[model samples]
Target: MNKSKSLTIINLAEKAKFYTSLCLGTVAFVSVFAFLFLIPFVVDPAITSLMADYDTVPVTCIATNHIYTEGISNCSWSSCKEGCTKEATRCHQIYVNYSKIPFREFKYQSHVSWDVVETRFLINPEGCGYPPSVNCSHFAKQYGYTTAGTPFPCYYSRVYPEMVVARYSWDDTLRHLVLSLAIPNLLFVASVGVLSYWYCPGCGRTCQKYMHHFPAEEDEYEENTYYNSQSFTKIHG
Candidate 1:
């Protein structure tokens, strides 16, 4: 009976260790993929925002008009069987025009047009997405555009007078920045745990082999009670 009990204890210990190690391995694997895919949204923008290089000065701006982008042209019946859901991209140029400060429009919302397209597609360095998923027909439906001739508050970079922003986003910049740094570090730690768990099987596994000898609190208490009763009977007899 005692021999069988000892074998059961060892088996339990082995299984426990195996599951623990497996969980660590899984976390490490997931962390790696998460960090890689999140780089564009988190890391890139964070680095630029953290630098504090660009200080925006307040400026009054107006949405003069809208010009469509060629992204919709690339869509065809074969390619866009779903009816060309590509959001209309536009020339969001914000610069000084005719003695007035013209700022780039933010998100492309309503005000649809197939003509008046941008001939030269300019890139925004601080923008998110790798291939740019922001401009889409679905995306436009969700967001809204300010009406033309409406005066709104805008910001312009002090150094770059030509550059203009619809609004400033310190909150997103800071949040994404933290997540960008935190996720990679978390991945690194999880990886180290996975490595250490598998690397020293002989060393750690040996200790784990004996872990089942330590009974659960309830079991230990029950056993102790039984042993004390037996000892008391012997003494009383």
Candidate 2:
């Protein structure tokens, strides 16, 4: 090829290689990050929500226990005489349960047990007739409750301890697995494959045409022609 044409082809090949390398590198970095970080955060929540919609299994409570906190009072003797008595009490109820269908069975027959607990807090404000001398104001402050005015009667209750299972049908599980794990990897591999096809030396058309011309054969032919020309010049001189 002529010098200018060869130089142009060489520049085009170099630009192609640079862009292909950049594209492959970006794909690799993003794939790694998505697998390690982004995928887990997204897939876990989606899986959990999906399971909640279709895979909740109920089990009976095998054992139960109730723990009560000491009653607290906020009324002084004078206030108590004026029927301004207030008290706060808290109870924690704990339960032990076993899965109905063996939620998770191990080969060794040993597995971790799960427990559930419920907490309830009650506030009672009555006159001096009440027995316990609990300091309701102190209880409210200690338990992070509001005590703006006279502590009115109130109660709070909540249940605890939840379990999530991957209990979808075979088809659903397969679909989620493919979406979460296979798709990203396949996309990355496809991108690398395309880049390799476009920029690989000796194989890709761009690289073969520009970056890897058969210069060794051309050099050998030129050397032979120069030798033949010199011999002719000597003979004529």
Candidate 3:
């Protein structure tokens, strides 16, 4: 092949290699990010949502005046008494006074009945206390009615100072997944696109402008040289 043609082929090859390297580098970065950050934050929640039998039950908050929050309320207790009575096997309530008594340790376990499962939190009196605003008597009354036949009410009202129990929600898991995985992934993709376009080989503004101006200057110099050589040959002839 002619010298110019050979040079053009070599340049094309080099540009192809460079572009391929950039593509590979982008893929590597995305892979690493997905493994280190995305999988745990994003994939885990989706899997948990699919595989786990039930969404995590929130912490139960039992209040005074026979008020219960999160699980079952006082009024509905009668109608659902069968399930509620059955639930007694797996469910129970606890109160602690955080202000008066320091929490020493918190623990919990799961109880399964037939195909159903219930998570129960164990509160230690040494670490449990009641918040000032809560009415312990109401919780005691509610507990008394619900576990009329069971030994649960005795455990529910035994708080040192009397405190309410609350559980973390599934919404927290979703929120974390979005913040850690979804948002970061989107930002990374957008940044990579912007950067790739800005520095792309022939498509980049600076590269295109340089390639345009540089070839014209080279051609102009070659033409000038050719004319000078012709003038010298004619003079000699």
Candidate 4:
């Protein structure tokens, strides 16, 4: 009875392993096909977008220059007024704001990094002189002028800020998708692995039963041979 139960368990485990492997193969095949089919629509566009769009805006600024001197002070109030006139203006004031467009902003400097200053500025990597330079107070001061604070402003749409968009990255997107799928695949594979491993114990018991029967069968055969030999000798005598 014990042997029979062992044999039954072994058979069951073997069958379970076989079935589990079949199911895993089938599912893996289906997943591959689905991945291929859905990639053009679901993954391709996301990949293209993540890298292309960053915070950017268009603005116009007018250039101007202003000078003051003691000699010019004696020119008269009318002359001072004339100095402030349109023809004497160094530049015109204009509407220059990035808050109206989509952009991503970061702190100009951080406490962790001592090499920089904290400020707001537009990130324009392709701007004329320098790559990834901001038109912040520091940069402005180099030109012999200064703005009190908030050199770079977020582009405002209505009363709110716009969201910055960028090109999609396959690594980022696929990494997330893999993470979401990993745990479930692990659980299922582990379950199947356990079932597959279970086959040996029952097979061991069945083998033990067959081993025990072999010795008994050998003993019976020996006894029958001795009897037959004795009977043959008696008949010959």
Candidate 5:
């Protein structure tokens, strides 16, 4: 009886160790993946904002009324066509006129278009109506067009086009940021789960071995749990 109890305790200890190791391994795996994928979002504002700004098109493209513009941010304009669902409809219509600024390293051309799109969730429709208004007066005094500090200079046109600029709301920016972050995170989690499952086969086998020993030890302790019935039948014969 004492031997059987000792065996059971040893088995339990082994099983516990196996399961603990498995759990620690899984946590470590997930931690590594989280650190790798979550770093960029935390470190760089440009990268974090990159997704949010994805929907914004260049003021130059809007000025010319062109659907697409070279080197402009691309986005689905339809989602905001009616009105933004979240926040205060932080949407606006941008009217950028490039002629007023002085051209130095980069040239500025006055080519513009217009749009009444929701750029963010918090914008009030009262102060900013459905067809948002464009504010072009801010660019008048600047020597050169604001390039958003781009390495390449702003495109200049000799014709002095009255380009209409369209400014995007902050909500669209957030939407893209969230979508971008989600993609890698989901992939990381799936990978960690798969890896955890792959590495845990030994745990199941160990538990099965422990359970199989239970009946044999129990019979020994009870003396006739398994053999008593058969021996009694023989005696009757």
Candidate 6:
């Protein structure tokens, strides 16, 4: 009786463990998709909107000098070790001289990097490219200020006087939104579909049974055709 009871307990435990796998798999797939892919998309746009506080500084203000700078932007050391690349990061800032304002000088430095002066300004708070790599010479020609004496517009935040940028990067926000929706939903579906195949006993059994029957069914059909052909030959011969 005791031996039989122990066997029953073992069988019950195994069934419980197997039944729990589906629940675990559901949670794992949902959490991984939500945290890794979705949250960043939500957080980034909110932050970008806040950075969009800056507005264009008047074009009437003359830019006395335009400075173009270059620097090496590096991936993490681990990323580099894993064969990632380093790209050059370039920044352009124009020194704006306000002829009609309290602040005699203002710097139009529309970059993602942090600058700590009140007179500094940007066109959009989000600044330049994903990494802001616009060539200084190209920027000069495009903005109609080749050497920086010509007036160019940059933006500044009313609330945060020091906060400035060239343009709000709504494109990055849109890209993130699309990727978050597309990639996560696809990944979640695939992950859950694969996990269900293993976690659900009935699904596994159905697939396995079908696979097992396929070869036998094919062979049986072939055999029947061969036997019928042989019989016809015997009769007609």
Predicted structure with the largest lDDT when compared to the true one: 6
lDDT of 4 at 198: 61
User: Which prediction has the highest TM-score against the true structure?
Assistant: 1
Q: Local distance difference test, per candidate?
A: 0.49, 0.43, 0.42, 0.40, 0.40, 0.50
lDDT per residue for candidate 4 within 109-203, as digits (tens), equals 22221111221122121111222322323333432234332333332212112221112233555574564455445655665555445645776
In Å, residue 101's CA in model 3 sits off its true spot by 29
Q: At residue 36, what lDDT does model 5 achieve?
A: 61
Per-prediction count of colliding residue pairs? 2, 6, 13, 20, 31, 10
Model 1 / residue 119 / CA error / Å = 16
- Cα deviation at 165, candidate 5, in Å, is 14
Clashing pairs in 2: 72-134, 72-135, 73-134, 73-135, 73-136, 74-136
Q: Which ten residues in a row have the lowest lDDT in candidate 4?
A: 119-128
* TM-score (C-alpha) between model 5 and the true structure: 0.25
TM-scores for every candidate against the unseen true structure: 0.52, 0.31, 0.28, 0.29, 0.25, 0.37
Off by over 4 Å in 2: 54-183, 195-237
Superposition TM-score, candidate 4 onto the true structure: 0.29
Candidate 6 lowest-lDDT run of ten: 75-84
Better of 3 and 6 by lDDT: 6
RMSD per model, one decimal:
14.3, 19.6, 17.3, 22.2, 16.2, 16.5
Write the residue-wise lDDT of candidate 3 on 1-237 in tens digits: 699999999999989867866775676577557657657435564445433322233222222222233443423222112221133222234322121111121123233121111212222111122344223444345443553323121121222212222322346545755666665566567656665775677567776788799899999999999999999999998
How displaced is residue 69 in candidate 3, in Å? 34
Clashes of 3: 13
Candidate 6, residue 105: how far the Cα is off, in Å: 22
